[model samples]
Target: MKTLLSTNLIYSIMAKEAFVKEAADDILRLTEWIREVFEDGGKLLIFGNGGSAADAQHLAAEFVNRFLINRRPLPALALTTDTSILTSIANDFSYDLVFVKQIQALGKPEDLALGISTSGNSVNVVKAMETARAIGMKTVAFTGGTTRPGGDLAAVCDLVLNVPSDSTPHIQETHLWLEHVICEIVEKQMFGTT
Candidate 1:
């Protein structure tokens, strides 16, 4: 049991360390994208499945409410927050249309869509990214595994951040760290504070 715990801890630690090393440039680009959108009064539309969905809502709340510092609320919406819309879209159209339809209706050219998928291939997220692109909205994705430079989710997203690990927990953990980093940078840039 100790060996298993130690192995898991080491795996997570090494995965995060490698991600931090490899992701500096990509992180900069993503922060810039968020900065541009917020500067332009564009909202962020975020979504994902399961834990990623929860992460989407968490990130949105950070933008809409507060992150580390106190400031005016930023505009951010998580498509996964509305169960009625999700169920309606799934029932009336299809499960894949949940986020796509929302993006089609709520998205604008200046807005941004962010999708989080551990496998980098969630169909609904891929569809949402595609729709957001066709609408001229910028798309960004947080996905798992470093092996896929750009997976199916990459075809539409303007930026893709893939955590360099196969373990879902490790991927999600790294994603949480990135989300905090992104919110902090965006808040600081938008509000002009530390």
Candidate 2:
């Protein structure tokens, strides 16, 4: 049992190291994209499922409320919030249409959509991305390295930031860090030295 635990730990470390080694450029690009969107006065809309859903809310809150520094509130929305909308849409149109319906209603041409999925696949997220694209909104995807059904979301998005790990836990950890870093950049760029 001890040996098994040690082996798993080693694997985890190795995987995290590999992800860091490969994802630096991607992270930088993602930050740039975020900066551009905010510079253009584009609203940011985010969504995901389960842990990713929590991440979506966390990131959006950082923007809409504040990140590391004090600044004016930015325009950001987390689709995971508003249980009324979620349950109503899920019941009326099916789970896959929840986000899509919201996008159709609230998305605008200058807005940005950010969808997070560890596996690069989430039907609802994909549907929302597609709707955002149709409405001329820019799309961004935070996804794991693996190719899943929702993997095409990355391809279609204006910017697809893929964390270079297949391990779900590690991928989520890195995603939170990336989200925080981007929020910091946005805060500084928008509010100046905040």
Candidate 3:
């Protein structure tokens, strides 16, 4: 058991290392998108399910509050935050429309929509991205690498950060790291802070 645990630990780190190596350019591009949204005075609407939902909330908090800097709050919102809205939407329009309805109401062309899903195949997430595109809102996705036929959320998103791993916990870990990295870069660019 101990040996297996150690091996898994090494494997997870190696997976993240490989993903970061391959995705450095995309991550930087994502940082630019985030900076652009903030510079343009647009807010972000982020959402997901399960562990990804947690990531959405965590990342949004970092942005709307502070990540590592003491500058003004950036406008970012996690769509999963409001339980009342979520339950009401689910009841009135089905779970599929939960995010799409909200996006339809609050999203604008200048805003960025970020959808997080480990498998890149959440129907609701994909639907929301589609709606964002139709509305001219820039869309981003943080997902584990996807190979499913026609189930790839990346296909609809303007930017997709696919962490190269299948383990949900490992992928979530990488997602958190990438979010922090992006937040740090955005802060530096938007506030000129190190």
Count clashes in each candidate, considering only residues at least 3 apart in sequence or on different chains: 0, 0, 0
Q: Sort every candidate by TM-score, greatest first.
A: 1, 3, 2
Q: Show where candidate 2 strays beyond 4 Å.
A: 1-16, 147-150
- Sequence-dependent TM-score of model 1: 0.95
**Of 1 and 2, which scores higher on lDDT?**
1
lDDT of each candidate versus the true structure = 0.90, 0.83, 0.87
Judging by TM-score, tell me the better candidate of 2 and 3.
3
Cand. 2 Cα-lDDT: 0.83
Name model 1 segments beyond 4 Å from true. Answer: 192-194
Identify the candidate with maximal lDDT.
1
Per-candidate TM equals 0.95, 0.87, 0.94
Q: 1-194, model 2: which lDDT tens digit per residue?
A: 99988987786676656666777786677677677777788888999999999999999899888897887788889999989999999998899988999899899998899999888778899889989999999898988765452376776687777766667887887788778888887677667784
* Candidate 3 backbone collisions, by pair: none
Ranking by lDDT: 1, 3, 2
Looking at candidate 1, what is the lDDT of residue 104? 92
Q: Which stretches of model 3 miss by more than 4 angstroms?
A: 149-151
